[model samples]
Target: MKNDVKEFFDNSEHRPPKFGVLQGVKVVFSAIEVAGPLGPHFMAEWGADVIWLENVNGGDTNRNYRPSEHEHRNDRSMSLDIFSEDGMAVFKKLVKEADVFLVGGKGPSFIRKGITDEFLWAINPKLVITRISGYGQEDADPNYIDRPCYDGIAQAMSGYMSQNGTPESPMPAYPYVGDLFTAMFSLSSTLAALIRARETGKGESVDIAMTEVLMRLSTYNMVDYLNDGRMYPRPGAKDPIQGATGIYKTKNGFLFTNILGRKQMKTLFNMIGCEELYGVGDFKEGFSFINLNWDKADYVESKVEAYFKTKTNEEHIEIFDSMKVAAAPVLSFKDVVEHPQYKARDMWVDWDTMTTEEKYKGVNVVPRFKVNPTKIWRSMPHIGYDNDVILEDLGYSEEQINELYHKGVIFRNDRDK
Candidate 1:
């Protein structure tokens, strides 16, 4: 495994030093787009020897996407016809040595391709197979089990979309939160399975459904209605269950505040010239100061809103800061990029990209580690960029590799070049 990692660095024209906790973990994944490829992307960053399998036909759906560069880094790309006999033979050989296998598409889709969890377990009993799908592998309703889905579909079906936005219109969170969350869950479950596999010498098949994972994430949104017949109103930019805890339009820009706790609420009310309102009705009850269920919520909210309209966001933020009320000026992307805290935290870094010589600036690796910190060794590769070296590592002779390429069992986008 050390030799393989060394070879990966030595073979590439431009490669950084590798440092991560998953140095010995070998992950082979055949997944496309966001939900599937993104999980292995993290493993690759963390020094797992990840081989991204793309069909010889056209490869992943993200083949032409620009944003895919960041997510596909630090991994080897292999274009193989996995449905063909020769391809399947190569795939099985890879699986035999792999610790984890991530398969995208529906369960039946893989079954028709002669790739099943049982078949894979037969090859390597300790293999953790993570199946990423729209719904799930098993369900009483075939329609749900086999439905074609993407990030938006999952968000819509999981009731996540309905919980967001204003009361009149619900919105799905942007930039594919559904897919991103599912990928994170997939990585987590796969790692858990890996621990169990090592402990008991038994591999486990994890069925990760996008909708199910999104629904799980929306647990807080559903519990109120599930336990009691009370449905919370969609608060848009407000904190759903708390008063004086939402975005307010100021004289300039917006201010967001979450005035919780009795002390904080008293401070906020006094700041807005509504201290009298804080001393009566439900406000007299136990810890009722920011409770949205208060009978005079509309009038109190109006007072707060009217007060905010008189001051600029920055001015209000300063007052809130002095008053010990949690508040912030609603910042745009421009503000965030130029933010002093953002710069001090070193939230962005620049690295070389595969598609060009220019450096790509992106968010740095999160949750910094003191030792074996993850690094981006290389940028995303073109289709089959590491075909020769990967196949060579698999013990195929140079001639045999060329033969596979000639047979259309293996493909490299740069082969002709």
Candidate 2:
């Protein structure tokens, strides 16, 4: 019986099969903040093995940005002082093994630290390196590269803030304008470089400026201004592509409706119990009543607003559904959490936090995959938490790891204590 059991155990599966889109790819991330860190977060979600490298001190400043109670406990921290010789040596070794390198620091700082592109490329010629900055690579004035900037600065320079908000009520846009888009662009470039490497066995450097990415987002407006010399004024909730599409205050919150053409206008009119307006001369097919006469918009909008005020959002939804009109309620954060559509689509997920006893939840995963489903592997790690494990994976022995710790080449909580 013992021999039979032993044989069965030996024959059973020893390791689970690897089944991820980027199963075998390895990425070494030395990025910080949203622009740098988000790149690896995306790559890791897609199944790449990403090792985050941090300095010997506390870690990236972003870790302190609104931490939940649960994140403090489970995350491991690593300390590597890159300014020191031993720290640089360890980092260089890690770069040698990495297929992709992502950095968000400026070129001058990297050059000063001896981690320049030339040095990194020399270590691994086939390495896909992405460098993200506030401004860009070219600058006629030397002081341009020296200027420090953040997401808001990039947004202002790239015309994103100017296009957002209304002409009368202009305000600052979201703070993460360039950072988020820069990460997406960097990831795209990295993937492209990876594909090129697979085909030609050569890699290239991808330089992404946050301002440049933000500028790309405003290309349509730029083209309009360049060709027609007409700067577009800030539009409110109304869409430029489709007229009579805007947000209206409902009984509960808000509702977005688009009654652009005669067909949709007729459907809306019928839904609102104003069926007499459908066959009117001004509402005829290709009449251009709303488009040609601006004053008609105010009259139509006032009637639509008054009609919408007669019913609750739920009632309006039912009416729209029955009429087959394109309409939806403007959902708030609280409403979104309890929304049936989000629940049905499995869009929101809960991640355990280490900062407190109670579990914390956030929107970490987004809806993309349908057939082969994937889950959140872990919440964002604490500062340098995977340091020892990563070093060990790099073939450093326990004794050597300890020695590096004493030399300030690595960091751990117990050592700090």
Tens-digit per-residue lDDT, 1-417, candidate 2: 011111111111212123346656778767667787776666665556777667766777676776322222222234677768777777777788778888786545565567767888788877888877776654514766656657887787778778878878655566576777888898889989988976886777887888789888888778878788767667677654334567877787788976555556666666556566555654564442244234344566667777878788888878777656678888878889898977776555455443445555655344354443333454555555566677787788999888987887777654342
Q: What TM-score does each of the candidates earn?
A: 0.92, 0.82
Computed on alpha carbons, the lDDT of every model, listed in order, comes to: 0.82, 0.65
- Quote model 1's TM-score: 0.92
lDDT of 1 by residue, 1-417 (tens): 111222333325422345788888889999899999888888887878899999888888786877787788787899999888888889988999999999888655786667888999999999999999988876626767777889999999999988888999999898899999999999999999999998998999999999889889888869887888677788888878877888999999898987777667766677778777767877773363566788888778888889989999888878778767778888998899899998877777667765687877777666565567676677777788888877777789999999999999988887765
Please give the clash total of every predicted structure, in order: 0, 20
Residue 368 lDDT (model 2)? 51
Error of 1 at 404 (Å): 1.1
lDDT for position 157 in model 1: 93
Alpha carbon lDDT of residue 361, candidate 2? 64
Please give the lDDT score for candidate 1. Answer: 0.82
After TM-score superposition, the amount by which residue 363's alpha carbon in candidate 1 deviates from its true location, in angstroms, is 1.7
